[model samples]
Target: MIESLESHPPQPRPIRWWVRACFGLTSPVGQRLYFYTGVGLMAVKYIVEAGFIRLMTGRTLTLLDFVNPLLSSRMQLLQGAPDWAGWALILWSLPFLWIAASMSIRRSADAGLSPWPGMLVLLPIINLPVMLLLAALPHREVERPYGETLGADDVSAAGSALWGIAGGVATGAVAFAMSVLLLESYGAVLFLSTPFFVGAVSAYAYNRPASRDAGSTLAVVMLSVLLSASALLLFALEGFICLLMAMPLAALMAPLGGLIGKAIADQCRGRRSHAMYAVAALPLLAALEFFVVHPHVREVQTSVEIDASPQIVWQNVIAFPDLPEPTEWYFRAGVAAPIGAHIEGHGVGAVRHCRFTTGDFVEPITVWDEPRRLAFDVTEQPEPMFELTPYHEIHPPHLHGTMRSLRGEFRLIELPGGRTRLEGSTWYLLAMWPQEYWIPFSDGIVHRIHQRVLEHVRDVSERSNGPPSRH
Candidate 1:
């Protein structure tokens, strides 16, 4: 009778209280409440914060103004946020979803199904009902396989501890790199899009079976082609265009890519699963295509005409220290200045240091261009406040050793109407972070700063011959 029982499937077990609670919480009504409440709270926060920023600035916030700070730390008006706040948010959010999924999986396991089937939560439009069904299902208690009779609590505790350690390290590394990129003035959009890759990988790993599906194969191939094309287009366009174009393209491609990956997996079923091999080969293919076919750097220029004579503007620029007053906001903020005090050389090899100050915080200049440009190679920064978690300690790197180059510049061109075209541009090669992670933020902030400086210069220079009228 025991042998017969073993051969027969185990009977379904009663659901535990905890499992029941999880099921209740993930019900359609509960999920709707959570989603809507979260959105409402986020909306409220944005509105309140935006209002406060506008009130402080005495000007209505433009979309760019509001978004710029969030995108680039260099533009951030908030003085004392922890460097790791962003990373911490990411870390904290992950465990919540993982736990919820685990509970759902447990409920599914009680229904005498493979835990892998719980991954249906990843499917679009179908996940809600699937999760609900999984949650509502009764649990089944079965005898454990040999060597698998460990205490549940102990196993869970060990897994949790491991996950925490790994998560902390990963979060810290990502935060550090992200902070560096933000400081360099990259955009936040690309950083925000990283979850798509995560989703795609998850789908590829979980949804593909050994069976071949034509639809899935077509989806994957088409998605890969679309993503590759979009990436190529972005590389070919200017920064702003790249940003504008890449966002919608990414949004469209990510879900499609996930579905395609799933389809590809399904197609390979019973045909000697090529999914693993495909995944392995993808990186190699990407690397080859990126390095050999793509242009990593393309240069472009713009000119802004200043009303002042080239010689006069050049004098003011070269003799920036002797100027009557600080004309630009950056200059007023003590972030940058004319060539005299900061730089020693008038040409390429001349070394000068420019300083950026925000209240008590100051960034030292590592590279100074005489008569034209200045660059701050940020070597180190103070430890962010929130990184002082009990579980892990973060130490700020020493500035002297950590300095990578930050580049900035100005160009002077003689124009008609006794005017000079003062074209300003800056460039820096980012290190300590993936270029994809922070380049958009960097570009947006740099562009804003450049625009501000030029506008200020134009305003001051244009009004120099008369009493400055308020615009």
Candidate 2:
């Protein structure tokens, strides 16, 4: 039976927009108002936060850090900042959270979707798509009411799924070509935004013909991402290790696109131009990123205590024998492992050759403080990895010089009882976006390399002397 609102009069619109939007939980929200207001408020929030962060620390907060404000607590920029600043950022987010939740819940109901999905706004990263999807969905007609679920029968569902997956795959392929083939760069647009756009397009395609429940919609989106990824492998565009490394990123970004796509399909049932506009914008953004984005040098340091004195350790540090076969799986899986070290001359002007599994790093000695400090600038370095591909040899662009070793240094400190402290620091450049995510991988590999060399030095130094003499 159809319900009638004829007998009951509607509530008057509140004068203050905040009361209407933030506190108007029981009322329905229109799609345009929801999207625009959400975007406008978010922009304002960023402006305020950016100004505050800059004022407090004289440091600009990256988009990744600003998106998730909780990161402020752990950020180095906020280290010396007043305790109230961090707390203030946290407190500032509360009202926005309230506004988001309240708006999402109402918007979901208004769009004929269940209000439960609205709570997803609380989750980091995932909430972005949820909000976008909610905003994309058109408000349900007044007669349809809020409790109804939207979907077609199984036959239509299958057809939509197939089309959705195809659409998503095509979107991903195009994005891959534009970013990799044309731009020849792997920025966030390729790794992060593409998957999201693909997912969104897939979900939108799936629901365009006939709306599916959120579960079926998400399932289709996942399958689309999987199929698109498999296509890269099938066509030999990417290797297994690279794809495996990228899966987490793709998986993290895609579903939200699907959610929003599905919402858009359900609400604005006839808009074909919207998807086209999005598709067109992606390549332009990639081109802009190519011109604007540049990699920054990051340093990784590792230290080990040796049983022998600095004099003994210095001998091994300057030139070490071949390391034993690496037992670690990462090394076996093609990550470069240090092989040995050899020097051409004895002093500051000498050249050092550090051999790795892939090739050699040519280092020109800049400092030669015997038994104290040794530093060198890496003039030339070999490929970082050998891709585990089915093909005999595939030289991907990233393998060439994306991860570059700029310089390295070894510090030796004399310790009590004829001991030494050896510290190895490598400064390198990585051209990967969301540095927070990729830095760990590079840091971990660098640390392992440092450990291997340091341990070898320790062992060699210990063997040089008959035995350690305790005073």
Candidate 3:
């Protein structure tokens, strides 16, 4: 029923170029640059990020950061931007976003689907499957309401294979150069730009009916990722660990990128000539996104329940003895593990020092509601982790200052069973892009820290005949 409703004939004018560049409707679409068109234009986006964008950020971006799973965040929300540059960078993203949206719109229209489906191209996570499904859909007989219809495409399997090769080469060079040279050490380069570039370019290059199949799109993207990965490895630009981490990302992102590229490519022709110059622009855009849009720090919270009274727990909460040796392998590796804490002073202005393997967190007490709540602000802190790197001395920017424990607290919620729901929260900032990769580690580290404290508190409280923490 839905298909029957949207499956209308091509009963409209061609979508215009500049208009098509901005919007996906009305202008008469000429030269459906489907595969080639998408690739070339996509490259333009990267070029903007790599070139004009780098001048904004004060950090030296490097390819090493791209492959490192634990790269530090370059978000400037804290330090702020160079007034004009920050806002200007944001404004610049408009065309890049619009072009991407327009490409998807045209692709959807070419597939004889509604324009609304095109917006799915802009989505994250689910965008891949959505694109692949759209690519698999058969092209309908229509006036191509979004763009001008072209004649039979000469794109063959062999041509597509070549396209994949070409796109891979282009993707690797631009992605590396953008990250290393432009200093766009943001996560988007590795997580968004690289896979997307290869996937989209390969799918478009295929430029054949088979390109519409999910299998074909998936295969092309996989091939492109492999080729690109191989090249990076050969150049020593990427390490084995980085490649392993990048696998799932490539699996999802590449296919999604290819399908979106294919859909857009299906609408226009003629990028065949200009694709070279457009692709040439990717490094620039990669740099721009890095400088203009620095990754922002975010916080995560975890809680647990202890079978001890708040009065009993508050003692250990304020300060405790040393923690037992960690049995967890992660703790033994490189992640920071908590030991114990002790406080100096008696009231709201008291100081607390919680020690970890790497360093001590210097905290100052703020609110002290005995047996009920205890809070403090992190005034000084230590490095997040000791390098698990297989080197004599390992120091990465992320380990030193990227992550910070801004503040912390311990809350004791009274339950009817003479027990307390102990919730320990560490207000910390993760200054890293693609938090998806590093967050789990951060969360675990905090939890382990909390667990050590909470459990110790429980032990001490239950063992002693101490007075209840009076409200």
Candidate 4:
């Protein structure tokens, strides 16, 4: 009877491409995720994008500049010369979105969670954290018809960990290379997407039976660090800076990625199952790069009501002394906080040099209505900020041209009480995508820059008597 029971363990029908069981992602049942399924899908996406970019620009994409949707202005697509890449990418992306949403809904239901969260599948870039979190959830104890629990014997950690990490590292490295080679960008590639790869590797590391939480956590961190270090050594990415910069970034993202990877791997029958989800993410990633991470112009304006008149405020606006040492952590941590301002002339056509720690922003006066308005075009841009880490100098891409300051203006509005509402405004374009994440930091930095100058103006204007009344 025992021999018969051993031979008669609960069995299900053989898996097929159109198998009903395959449609639902989550199940207590086991299913095999065929090898290379994930990679093949990603390749399809790469070909489509490369073709579109090449057709639109008459040049293949390169590892030159930040190549995200933000770089494609409507002028490139709608206005003067229509570059078809935008519309091409958009229309082609719909089917992939459908697939992602469907998979998410199935995955959510299998998790014993509502499918509503699966709505995140439709959102790009941001949806990664949500889905990864979902992936980390353990299966419900109660079994449904999905295929008998993943079977007690899963791939041992000893066997799967190294394989998963190696595969995940290669995958993430490839993705990074694609971002640079295929898209010519880094922010979304590194900060936004790499975590998943780290997670994949970590997931593999934790795949064994009876895994310890702390040990697993350390394993994930070490694997993520290794992945980052390897990128520098093998691929010529950010070099030593990655030890502190990339490692911290990896530490923040890899643990999460690992959990999700593990969850995906656990749900599937084979050790390589996580790649399927990673592959599916490629289309979503593309959608994000083009639509969600698309670049847009951002303007920041900050105003302060000063006790003195416009003439007094205007005097200091043209030229100011050194700023007090920065107390804010953001500034101290190497963001190029404003130091002072001094100009070569008094009116329109004069050159104004605004100094920051990294370097000076050369602003040539464009409009000057004495005591009321002062506008200037940023003729020369400087590094956006510096990394605080000990180094003679660091040159991160975003610091170079990814963030550009186009123009700036000061509007001095005379208030009722001899007070002047001194408004300092800056127009800029952040080349990076994932605006929702980066905007807050950019906005705050701009505000502080404005504040440093405006507050200095307020102090000097109020500190001294009113400027000689201009006719």
Candidate 5:
């Protein structure tokens, strides 16, 4: 009966003046202005709030720390709040943004366009023009209003919903089972590969009428499961992998999710095609992730003046201690530090293993270069006492394997005065979680850590010129 309703002609409604006005100004230029203005205002608000938080904390704030409190507390409160509250909160809270977006999708019956076009909003910049175009289109009257009276056609809606839910649940269960089975052995590879499956499923769901509802639900579930597993892996591994895993997942899932969403909208609303639009949107979203979301990994250099001869400072810096004092910060922090190896057998692959034991954690040396640089690649970590806490699990493979790439270098220059200028640079990548959700947080953390590490090196290097001191 529901399928047969498709033959009924849509009645026309008089377009409201305000709606017409909105549509008239919906040109590319006006859309761009509206979007840019909205984005700019959001940026300013975040910046000001960040500054205020930094002042209060007496330390630089990262995006994660800023949202952590809200995610923990006010998230539930937001659901019952008004529409303005939903919009404002979403502007501020990353997690809520997804929900707010889902709600923004009105039924196709309310708008003249097929429901599939609603998926366009998921595309980045391209969605702006599409939305304006949609607003400009005329509305259609409902042939048979929903919930006014029961009709045979209503059965299809119920069937569609049921099929969607069942499909989503079944797929999610299978993925979860696969993940669990693979957890002990090929966990890393399986976790890394999840994004591809998610994308494929999402694509399949949107493209097929029977699968639409199920696909969206399954995507959400899969996303949650993958995220949890990935986070666990990050804690276990703790370095490059955290960031690496996110890239493939985002590349696949984002565009595919958008496509599926558009497909569902089209089927419900009777739209023809959105193929060209989806093609254009994929790269734009990827670009946004690369430039706007990814954190900058920079090598910083600074010179610290020390009232010691260059030879003496160089000797101390280059000394390959068999059992170095635990005072080295990285050593004490339980991160692997280089101890007894050189960069190469003669030039590049030397291995130094320095160990640090801080109260909270221990670091072991992963890479060691004498006289110039040292690197720590964290492979193992202490177990967490709590299950739900972020730090409780072992860093994932992505984070652990990649973290070992961090390197710090020191250069000594002789001065006319009986002093040495110690120049140093530290290089490390910022491995962030939930890439899109925590972009601002990742940027803030990287910036603050970079500043702090440089400052510490300067203070320590300069103080070394005096009598031996504790750090």
Candidate 6:
């Protein structure tokens, strides 16, 4: 009997209610359960998020801030927050959002309604009323058969994959057109929402032909993004470096999209999925983000010690000779490197011209406290970098003014003996959303720029005269 039982397939383990509620694809959630559970979970999520934000920022978030659907106010809060806060909040709340979405979809099925309306839970402002409406709706006793044939077997796996890729690429192209070509935005909508929908739409389409396992869906979504990236490169729409820089953020979001896609595919089976139409919202969101949100100023400071006095270092701080051709791979890879600097006149009101491989920065001297501090306002700056692209060159919109240096200052602090501590700070604005993700790159690049200039100053000052008299 034991041998026979072993030979026979064992009974499938019963899924717990909580597990089904949280992650089940085919479970139908009744109205009373869905309403109370959703409300309670949402409340818990809000309280937890607010508490975390309070702890991280030392500032309390009001209920108004929590319920508001507008991105502007939320982004402003994040702007003031520590670099890790936004990312932490996102990581924290993703599960809540996922649970809410799943419950909504399942609740719709219980109410004998299209699961498409349930997807509104992912949208803002509208989601509140959607939940209320879903809660009020009475459950209908409809017995839907599981795993009913949807003609998926008719289409081959390779064909399904190809269709998914095409759909994903199309979605990305539309986003690129709206955000880059039309509105000239490099904000969160383009960076965050686009990748999400790309993964979602692609996964939905791929699974529409035949629903695959989670791992397969992830693979398909990743492949889709890779193809979309290739499309950008081959079409000369974006360069290698820009795309490479974007990859990390894109990678972070795309898998979540894939998971959502897979969820929709698994849950909304036998019903036509509304994922394609959902992608249409990308342009509208982009428009909203572009109009309401603007880039904020950020500062980066880098310091180095030199075996020279403040007076000797001050001379090089004002203007320096040509730097040798950059040996850094990033500089060689199209990031502009400082070549030389020249000053037209003496003291304050003098125009200091700093030359980079790409072009010049026209800086007007504001303070010229000899041997101590040097400050200037950048009136004009050239292209941040030349994009590494095929063909002659492609002038992507971001290269022009996305990153701007507003002002800069160099401080020379005298230390024991004859050595000096040189600190360089640049105040700039980066027109990118999710500042936490991009700030590090910007800060590092700026630091590199500072290092090149400061190091050159050190070499020159140490090798030359001890101290110079103020003009």
TM-score of each: 0.35, 0.74, 0.55, 0.62, 0.39, 0.81
Candidate 4 weakest lDDT stretch, 10 residues: 29-38
Each candidate's lDDT (Cα)? 0.37, 0.75, 0.59, 0.58, 0.38, 0.77
In model 6, which range of ten residues has the least summed lDDT? 144-153
Q: Give the per-residue lDDT of model 5 (tens digit) for 1-471.
A: 223323443344355632332222111112222233334444665676556444433445455544442222222222222224323433454322232123223323244433334444444334445545543443456553211222122234444444433433343334334433322122211322233233433443333443335445445435544554454444443333333434544444443444344334333333343333333333334333333332334343455666666655654553323334435443343333332322223323433332222112222344444444444442333221112233544433232322222455556667776666667554544333232233333333333433443344434445566653222
Which numbered prediction scores highest in TM-score against the true structure?
6
Q: Tens-digit lDDT track for model 3 on 1-471?
A: 234424642244355544555444333222233333444554665455445436665454344432222333323321222334433443455455455555555565667665445544443333445545554555566643555534545557777677666876676677666665446253555565567667766776675333356676667678778877776556555444446555765666676566656654554544231233334445655555455543344444445555667787788789888988877776676567788899999879999999888789899999999989899999888776665333454443445455777788888898866777878887677644445454554555677777767777776776674444432
Q: lDDT value for candidate 6?
A: 0.77
Q: Is candidate 3 or candidate 5 better by lDDT?
A: 3
Candidate 6 residue pairs in backbone clash:
none
- RMSD versus native structure for model 2: 8.7
TM-score of 3: 0.55
**Model 1's lDDT to the true fold?**
0.37
Candidate 2 residue lDDT tens string, 378-442 = 99999888887777877777786668899999999998988899999999887765444555566
Q: Which stretches of model 3 miss by more than 4 angstroms? A: 1-173, 176-190, 202-220, 223-247, 259-311, 329-333, 344-346, 382-402, 414-418, 431-449, 465-471
Residue lDDT tens for model 4, 335-420: 78888889997678999999998889999999999889999999897787665433455564445666789999999999886889
For candidate 1, lDDT tens digit of each residue in 1-471? Answer: 224333544345355743444333222212222233333433554575556545444334454543332232221332222334333333333333343343433344445454334543432223455655664454455443111212212223234333323322232223223433323222222222232332334344443323224344334433443444343334332122323433453444345434433433332222332323222322332232223321122112235677776555554443234224446553453222322224444544544443233111122445444434433433332211112122332223312122222344457766666666787655434322223323443343345545654655665566663433332
Provide backbone clash counts, one per model. Answer: 22, 3, 42, 7, 60, 0
Q: Give the Cα error of residue 232 in candidate 5, in Å.
A: 8.8
Number of residue pairs clashing in candidate 3, backbone atoms closer than 3 angstroms, sequence gap of 3 or more or interchain = 42
Q: What is the lDDT of residue 453 in candidate 6?
A: 94
Write down the TM-score for model 2: 0.74
Encode model 6's per-residue lDDT on 1-471: one tens digit a residue: 224323543344455866676666566676666765776686887788677766666676677777755433443455445556666665676677667776777787678765645755665445677788887787776555222334344567678788877888788889889989998889777887788778878888788767787787888888888888988889888999999999976787788777767666655566755775667777876787677766667677889888888988999989998999999999999998999999999999999999999999999999999999999999999888889888698888888778999999999999887789999999998877756567656767888999999999988987795442221
